[model samples]
Target: MTRFDAATADGRRELFADAIRAHDERDSAFLTIEAAGNGANAGNDAGSGSESTPWVQFADGTLNLDCTDDELDRLKSLLDEFPSFTVDDLTTPEDVDGTNVRVVARTDDERVGEFVDRVFQRVYNRPDGYRAWVTVV
Candidate 1:
């Protein structure tokens, strides 16, 4: 299993998306993904929280890829394709215990779960080991 270090917002999103795709494709049950908040930038206040000063927060998740080698490769490939998708308002190098990678997402839409699910299904198909924080939006 490849060790994924999602220290940044973009990296986190990519990692999360990849894990979801891997779960959908291989039907792996051991691997579990969950949204995790380490309080990296939780209450840093970005202006007045208005349109111009949209408060940025860390939306985090973890992917436990305990699957076979094939599954791991598939997950990696999915992550590599994340740049194809458009992700805005994200910060880089989300520090978690002094590690960094880049993981974040804009949560303005109520259908975030649906959107994530759709992205997973559109790219792969298995439906497991992928979760996100709905309140981020």
Candidate 2:
């Protein structure tokens, strides 16, 4: 499949976030999309599951739906129109300049794991790889 990258840093972030929201929207459990903290920012985890928990923050620094999967393929297909959607990164998550959207709704452990994964994905990955991510099925 063809891979797509956002035109600008902000666009890249938003593209990733869109893929996330699209995939997450597949599940009925995902009910809401909220903002979160990052970088030097103090974050606003208002609509969350429990205290001190992590969440699925998207690229562009905002938005990831929750409340939760079958439609994952369908939403992924939508990326075809974007010209930048890639299969690799969608499975994984990235964070640059505090753009990853908050990932709430899941267990605290899962949230934290996801958070760390995003950081590592961007940190370890090369050049624009920072915008790309690697994940397990």
Candidate 3:
């Protein structure tokens, strides 16, 4: 898998353009958009979950979403509105500029895909927004 950073509006445009191209060519895959957080490196301390950082694990969820510190409260509030969704992990990188969150939406079963588009729209529409990349699942 490869990553294309959409840190700017132009970058976002280019990233989507590439995704469209890939889709048009019929090589569709998974895409992830999350907090870039001032380019900070979320390093890990040697511990039980030391193998990978929380953000990485969170991104591996059924529906991946994230936001900056400025939007954390609102994000949490949005999640609260839907009991089917529960925050699995919330990671704040030491000495970093923001937080990364992971949520899982499941009631009787994993009812997630239906909520992704709505959740992602709210996240990326924020003024401080988040980040994104594409992976060939």
Q: Tell me which of candidates 1 and 3 scores higher on lDDT.
A: 3
Give per-model TM-scores.
Answer: 0.26, 0.25, 0.45
- Lowest summed lDDT over 10 consecutive residues: which window, candidate 2? 128-137
How would you encode candidate 2's per-residue C-alpha lDDT over 1-137 as one tens digit per residue?
Answer: 12333223344355444445454555323322222222222222322333222233333322242211322333334334323323333322343222222322232323333433333223222132223221100
Each candidate: RMSD: 17.1, 16.3, 10.3
**Clash count (model 3, backbone only):** 1
Off by over 4 Å in 3: 1-64, 107-111, 126-134
What are the per-model numbers of colliding residue pairs? 16, 26, 1
Better of 2 and 3 by lDDT: 3
**Candidates sorted by lDDT, descending order?**
3, 1, 2
**Per-residue lDDT for 20-137 in model 1, tens only?**
4454466554333333222333223222233221111223432111223343344346545554323332222344222112223333222233334333333323233322221221
| Local error of candidate 1 at residue 71 (angstroms) | 33
Candidate 3's residue-wise lDDT over 56-81, tens digit each?
A: 21222334444576567767777777
- Highest TM-score, which number? 3
